[model samples]
Target: MSEQQKTVALEAELDALRREVQRLRARNAELEADRGFPGRLVDALPSLVYVLDLEERRYVYWNRELAELAGGNIGAAAGPLRGDGLSSMFHPDDIGRIEGYRARVAASESGEQATVEYRARGRDGGFRWFLERGVALGRDPEGSGRRMLGSAHDITAHKHTEQMLERSESLLHAFLEYTPSMMVAVDVEGRLLLVNREIESYYGMSREELLGKVVYDLLPPAASASIRKANDEIAAAGQPGASEHVLVYPDGPRNYLSTKFPIRDAEGKLYAVGTVSVDISRTKQAEAERAEMQRRLIEMQQATIQELITPLLPLARGVVAMPIVGTVDPARAEQILTTLLEGIAARKARIAILDITGVKGVDAHVAQSLVGAARAAGLLGTRVVLTGIKPQIAQTLTMAGADLSGIVTKGTLESGIAYALRARRRS
Candidate 1:
């Protein structure tokens, strides 16, 4: 009875063990399917997945995406990339960066991660930008990197956009810097967001010091206020306007013709003010100098004309003859008197003959001027002999109540000269 019972129990135990083995195999199959699902997902992804055995300094695995991009399995024994180094895939300009990032990730502790963006050359002879992220996966026995898991995303489109933006900004900066005028951009709050080289040089400051500073911080109070007002008007009107500004420099006061306009975004909203200040100091100073020179030139021309009109000529010893030609106004009359006295004193003339043969018309001022000249000459001990007195002029002078009775009058210049000679003989 004991042998039979033992045999039956053993058979039952064997059956239960078989069932357990079958259940365990089923569970293992399920777990393998789960793992295979993730592997399939990785292969199907657009991003390239890879594993690097840093201990051996070689890439251990790469997904299908990388194999397709590289034209072969990156890790397969018969693949085109089988023995090639990972650095060969990178662009020459990016090799150093890729190598540096790899080294940094390898030196990091487990679970450490790093990201880098670089250009990778494909088998198609095209370069594409990749934003690759690497994670350290534990270390080897020698305290060196064992494995690194990384994913590379093709960021070529994003990089292109970034480059385009950078180029646009660079072009704008160059245009502003090389412009002849001082260009400045300020936000609505009056903070300086951008300034050209001219502005920096004009203010004697650097971009770092000027940027983000208020407009009033760098300029004189009056200039700042004026600029602010102009900016406000431009912003309010959404149109360009101009104003004059004076900036005191180390050398002297400099004038500027500033044109200010509003800068709008794509939505046509005013966000900044653009100012272009053209230096007008030299132009203004030159104009002022030209005007002064013109004044001096006019004075010189008048003096030459006056000398031409009145000439006191020496006729005989101690006698001077002056002839008035053309029209004689009060100024010319005064000039005539001055020249007569100077000649009389220079020649020590006791007799002076005044000629008016070319006289056209004589006004009251001219009459008074003649009378005044005679009295002045008499005081200098010179007897003035008036000549070439037209009857009409004499009547006009007499009717005008001009007192010329003390002056000796002659009808002709020849008579005056004769009388002067006779007077000289008497002297």
Candidate 2:
């Protein structure tokens, strides 16, 4: 209970504490020795493992891979890796991103991990993409970053693959958007899945407005019906089919040659119908115009032929000679009748000489046509004089029951003209 006894007890307790501390240190060393070789183990890994003193902005510990990635020995003698040190190691465009990640990791709580991907300069002086993940170890007394541990894995191949995929998607999008035909895809339920720029432009609507809508919703009932029929046929046959229809736009109607085909996946299961329509309105209009022109041309040709066959020549003051050449069918006979009646009314002719010098033979119909013409002209007060009937034609007409008794017959066109003039003089 005295001061000496208390002092002795305090010394004993202090000595015991020191011995316990020494034993703990020895145990830690033994544990470290029992583990695998740290240097060889770290150097064998492909990824760059490192520890950093964030307060001093220096790499406290780094593996051989880290040194190789940095293109230098990475230790205390290598100098601190701050903004400038890191900027030199990263791509110029990626420096800002690296700095942003550094700031984030420095502010993170202990055991909080942060990941960043950036292009880093390699030993070969070429930049390669790397994915780095860091955990905040602890903070300093002032609440600043004290230490951090991280690993960096080369992701150059992954980044390159990503870029290639992006380019392929962009190219496919461009091809679908700018193709000239109106391309569209509809699901089995008739819902639109895809639409091209041509379809958007032709319908004056955006793809957003067209997609997910039923084809019937975008088109008139008539047009939608036709399209539905074509789609059904394609779906049933699992093949392509052609359809032509008029697409009535807000401006006007346009003809389109639509080709519909079944869309199948690699598994050969029919999933949708793909349609490609080309505007054929101009072609259709051209064909219609050509047909109209052909009809008009035929009318002109017939008019020319009729005029050549029937020619009325006036000889005397009151006499007119109509010379008919070539065989006259019923149509030509009707034309002759019309010409003779018109000429008689215009000229007020007292005698009309009908010349048929070019006639080979007159059948029953031809003889009737002549009789009908003469009777019609008599009713109009124009006497008929038939000319240019050969003897064999006259005999043929008589044998075929010809009834031209009431018509005056002449041998030649000249004789007919002379007779008409003589009759006019007497009058």
Off by over 4 Å in 2: 1-52, 60-86, 109-113, 121-133, 137-184, 195-211, 217-219, 234-242, 247-270, 274-294, 313-318, 360-364
Worst lDDT 10-window in candidate 1: 75-84
What is the C-alpha local distance difference test score of each model?
A: 0.84, 0.84
- Name the candidate that leads on TM-score: 2
Assess every candidate by TM-score: 0.62, 0.68
Instruction: Write model 1 residue lDDT over 268-380, tens digit each, in one string.
Output: 89999998889999999999999999999999998787667787788888888888878888777878888888878888888888888788988988877877888898899
Q: In the order shown, what is each candidate's alpha-carbon RMSD?
A: 9.8, 11.0
| lDDT, residue 34, candidate 1 | 96
